[model samples]
Target: MPGCCLWGSAPPAPSGERKGAGWLELLLLLLLILSGWVLTQQPVGCPRVCECFVEEKTVKCANQNLTEVPPDLPRDVQNLFLTGNRLRDLSSGAFPSEPLLELRNLSLRGNQLEQVGAEAFARLPNLKQLDLSQSALLWVSPMAFGNASSPLEELRLSNSLYNYSVVAAIAELLQRGIFQNLKHLDLSSNGLVSLPPGIFSRLPSLQHLDLHNNSLVSLRDVSFGALHQLQRFDLGDNALKRLRNDTLAQLRGLPWLTRLDLGRNAWVCDCGIEDLARWLKESDQVEAKEALKCSEPEEKQNSSLVSLPISGLECLEPDDDQTQLQTSYVFLGIVLALIGAIFLLVLYLNRKGIKKWMYNIRDACRDHMEGYHYRYEINADPRLTHLSSNSDV
Candidate 1:
């Protein structure tokens, strides 16, 4: 009878029924299917246009005609090669800054970049090397790279279309020590006429400096005061006439300096150049000593600066004794000329009196001659006087 009652109870509903479990399973199955579909729709890492080496963490996007940074770059990219791109300007957030935190090397060379925003590289904390060369850059904001979290080691802004305005802003940045950790800096081929005083004072760690192919007129003694660790200095192909002895002294302050390129410049080879010549000969710092030439003093023209003796290079001082003597002679001659002119003027003004005095002298001389003649005639009349005495007797 008990078995009969259990059968009527529908076998206890087969014992394992949980009412909500089917719906829960169905929901989980739908969620998993949805996740799989999403995963399949997403492409693999790296943008379609870029070739990324995930293992090496390097991205080669060079010459990609990329107008803007791709949005789908891997987050682990360290070296980014965006050279020869059509990137006009580096505005803030142009590239996803968060994804580029690990980026170390950035190459923007050959790009048509004219301006760079201040917050352009603010998000790249580990960035060390940057190449903005050949960018046709006309202006750079003074606040560019301001408060940068990166320790930029190498910077190349050379061959950019930097006029005085851009160069001045750059000088201001250098003077303020914006890139203090920079070791190698290339500012060559910039149309720089002159550098601001104490421009390199803040770059204490700078080891190599390139100022070649510029229109630099001079370098001051205090210009490299803070570059105590400088090893190489390139002033070749510049418009430099001469370097001051004091400036040479400042260059000497760098004990580690090994290579100096002073060739292809307009060297005067005068007294002011003696110190540099001596340095070129004696010091082992000059790298291209043989290539150095003098452009001035027709005699020293094209002569090798290194071989020229220091004694041969003598500058004529503007205030030297010889100059002073010449000046004094000129002054004396002028004074004599003035005196002679005054005398002539006086003679001309008193022409009538002078003429009357000359006439009076002529008359007096004539009267004296006539008197002499009359005396001679009287002496000759002595015989007549004797005849007259006889008649009186």
Candidate 2:
């Protein structure tokens, strides 16, 4: 009976055991409180000027008037925005003192960056996207990035690269096989007059190229020859008067091309632009098809390029120089024909004399051969020589 407990009836425990149980429960509660506090606290290592989101792993220092990159930043940040700053130069080790191994995207747009030093982004090994648009970037070292086989896929240099020299430098860098994994590139509003040949040859994976709002008068066929994966190309708002058939053929050769922008250009509706106008009519890839209008030749100033028929785009009457050249060619050809006819007529009129002269030459050759033959026989035999001499006497 003493060892057995009845229903809803139990024996009391010792005070020491009770106290031990209470202490254990208190310890568990304290531990939970501490863990909750740790979870709620803000992440450390955030720079004073930056707003860092711990959960998203993003750091935004945009429009902060920062002269340099913040020295203290979370080591695991993936996206960093440093736009609208006064960062004039980006030297090597441009990031924080310690490398951000997890960084994937970096933006330096709207900065006053004049130069980018060698291996400036060497620390960010996993970087995939970079934005340097709206900056005054005058120079970028060929080795600004450490790896030629970098994983960077998107690069924006719009509104930068003011002169041909800067563009040439960038072209040289691309030709060196840097950023081989690049996909999207923005070079719009760069005041480019012409792109260097084979400029995009090394970028085999490029899918989107934006070159709108430039001063490009013409494009070489080889400029986009290697962009087999290109899907979108923007050549709008340029100073182009006409596109050559070879250039249009090159555009058509892009297997993946889906969107093309050629509007807002100074198109001239003439024989020189027949190829482009015909291409516009036949192809549906051109964006803003209705806005492409002719700007020259008072009669076609406001005409749409897409609506103009190939027959309507006629060559103007031959200029004086062209007429003169054509006349000279015709005269030369006639003179040659007349000379040939005269020569034939002269040969016919002198046929008899020519035949007699030919017979005289043949007889002289025959007699001379016979004399040589007789001399050889006389030399070979002494009897023959004496006999011939006696006969002669």
Candidate 3:
């Protein structure tokens, strides 16, 4: 068979300077290739200072002397490290305004963050771990971490501003169950004096709590009542003088609690401290118990609070009623002895005068008795003579 001529007759092409037209087509194809190459060389919207790893979905922009969050980060970044920067404030949409659906870990440690707005991290829906440690964080809006789409597991706010208002705002969130799924929370070195009652009750999944290096003077029984899953509790380096029985008893309910740090506190080894000492002696989970020294009561100052026996702890001042009763008895005995001594002294000083007055009274009585007897005898003579004559007749 004659080869089937599929291309019987092709349409005639437009006539031009045929050689020049071929050259123009070649030039256009070269330009297109060069443009494609240039576009590939530069990733679209990648921040200049940030180093993005596409395969790992990570952005490492740490310690680059950045004044603010780098703009136009890849939307798919999962881990972002912004540590050691000059990020002063986190206003609304301060970071990349684009939604980051895969972002999980965000670190802002060692920054100068003075304020954090309510929606600062609203674009990150899947954020799980956040580190704001070592920042000069002075203000945090109550809704700063609100509206998170994912369950935040870890939050580190350590060594931030020691502001009560900031802590109270966090407390408000805790009370409202905003961090119910939080597992690890670091609130150390915040100069907190006392935690709000039931502040940690809503976080049922919390495992580790760091409250060390604060000025916490005491804790309420309800302050940690609902933390059943707590494994580690740190109360070290605080200004706690003693813990109440209810406060210590509340800890007994946490079956999973394994480690407790109560060292480096201002413990007072007094009668009121027996419960704490007994608790320490009974529980083996307390770490550094021997280092829990006393900071009050000159007699027990600097002594190991945990080692002191419950019987050895005594009140500096005895019971008021007992003391008053003993004092009254001593005072009464002294007064009675003083009265008796005075009576004896008076008798000894007036002994001669008393004797002379008794003698004079005796002499006058004797003379009056003799005179009465003589008068009676003279009156009776006539009757006696009459009686004798009558008997003789």
Candidate 4:
């Protein structure tokens, strides 16, 4: 229709017709309608000073440079990550009357909190993990952990608190068996001494314990006496002077001991460390069989306490007591062997005595036969005659 100017072409239908575009348009329009309905359904006003933004059911306004506690959260937020915030000093009643916090999987890590209020986390019955690490905490209130005996599976307090009070708090937890189901605990890089008594002992189900870079001097007896199911133990970079035999004696017997890292403790080279060295000799894991010598003070550092490998680390001479111990063991083995040899000698002597008796009986029988039937009764060959016998005629 070159000259007829046909008005029927419909401008080529505006090209780029999307497949199923009508259904997609309908779905988007329906979603918009639903969103409008939801907005209208909200009964109350929006919270002030809290950037309230919701997505389906979650409302997150974390990292708002909050000074006190982050309060007035949504009522149904199941997962809340309050990281990279300025919240400090979570006092009591910080999260009061907040319904969503009760069911939230909260993380308050990397905050500026100096002290955690007592019974702060007493609520939140459904909380699974509470991360308080990297908060630069100076103190921890008693009962700061979960209540009702159902603590979070992973409680991270690394770089959160330290010193005597932290130890005291952990000890208190141990005494009461508060962390019965705690799977992992991170107390690394803290100023801790030996494991506070009753703390590690109470955590029966603990699988991992991170206590690296602590100021642990010695693991005395009863230090790690309880961790029955511990798979990983990190005690690196600590100022450890000794790894006592009794302290780790129970751990050595654990059947599930797979990884033991005692790399940087600088266990002073001495007879005190011999027990571990000897155990490593018969071990299939852990490479501590060599003398664990001191690695500082270049002059006297290379020396070891004694030779556990029978030819290394001969710094200390075998003392009197050591010699006595060796002597006792050697004497015992030698005595047993000597007793066995003596018993065999006695048996041989008994057999020889029986043989001589039979020979004497046979000779007597022959002498009787000769005397009765043949010639002289007691006659004997010249070679067999005794000098003391009467001269034969």
Best prediction by TM-score:
2
Model 2 misplaced regions, further than 4 Å: 1-41, 316-393
lDDT of 2 by residue, 1-393 (tens): 665776556779999999999999999999999999875755788788888888999999999899888988888999999999999999986777677889999999999688988888887888999999998878888888865468899999999896788898888778888767899999999998878887898999999999999988778544678888999999898988888887889888998998998888887777777788888888877888888888978898989888887885667534221354578899999999999999999999999999999999999999989777777777789777656532321
Give the TM-score (vs. native) of candidate 3.
Answer: 0.67
Q: How many residue pairs clash in each candidate?
A: 0, 0, 0, 0
Q: 23, model 1: CA deviation in Å?
A: 49
How does each model score on TM-score? Answer: 0.67, 0.69, 0.67, 0.60
For 1-393, candidate 1 gives per-residue lDDT tens digits of 868876666554433555567778999999999999876654477777777776778888888899887777778889988899899888777778564778999889988788887777776777899999998777776666756434889989889855777777777767666676899999999878777667787888899999999987666434677888899999888887777777888878889999988888888867867777887888888886888888988888999988888785567444121354578899999999999999999999999999999999999999989777766665578765544322321
Candidate 3: deviation at residue 194, Å? Answer: 2.2
Worst 10 residues of 3 by lDDT: 384-393
What TM-score does candidate 2 get on C-alpha atoms?
Answer: 0.69
- Tens-digit lDDT track for model 3 on 209-245? 9999998877754467788899999999998877878
Every model: Cα RMSD to truth: 28.4, 24.2, 31.9, 30.2
Candidate 1's TM-score: 0.67
Q: What alpha-carbon RMSD in Å does predicted model 4 have with respect to the real structure?
A: 30.2
Which candidate model has the greater lDDT, 1 or 4?
1
Tell me which of candidates 2 and 3 scores higher on TM-score: 2
Q: After superposition, how far is residue 296 of candidate 1 from its true place, in Å?
A: 2.2
Query: Candidate 2 at 41: error in angstroms?
Result: 5.1
What candidate 1 gets wrong by more than 4 Å, as runs, is 1-43, 97-99, 312-393
Report clash pairs, candidate 3: none
Please give, for residues 1-393, the per-residue lDDT of candidate 4 as tens digits.
674546555444433565467778999999999999987755243344444444444334466676654555556666666676787877656664553444546778888567777767775766667788877676666566545676567778777764677667656755667777778888887777666665676787877778887877666544565777878777777877555566557777666666666656665454445666666566653534344466543554755433434334444533232354578899999999999999989878798787899899999998877555433333445653454344432
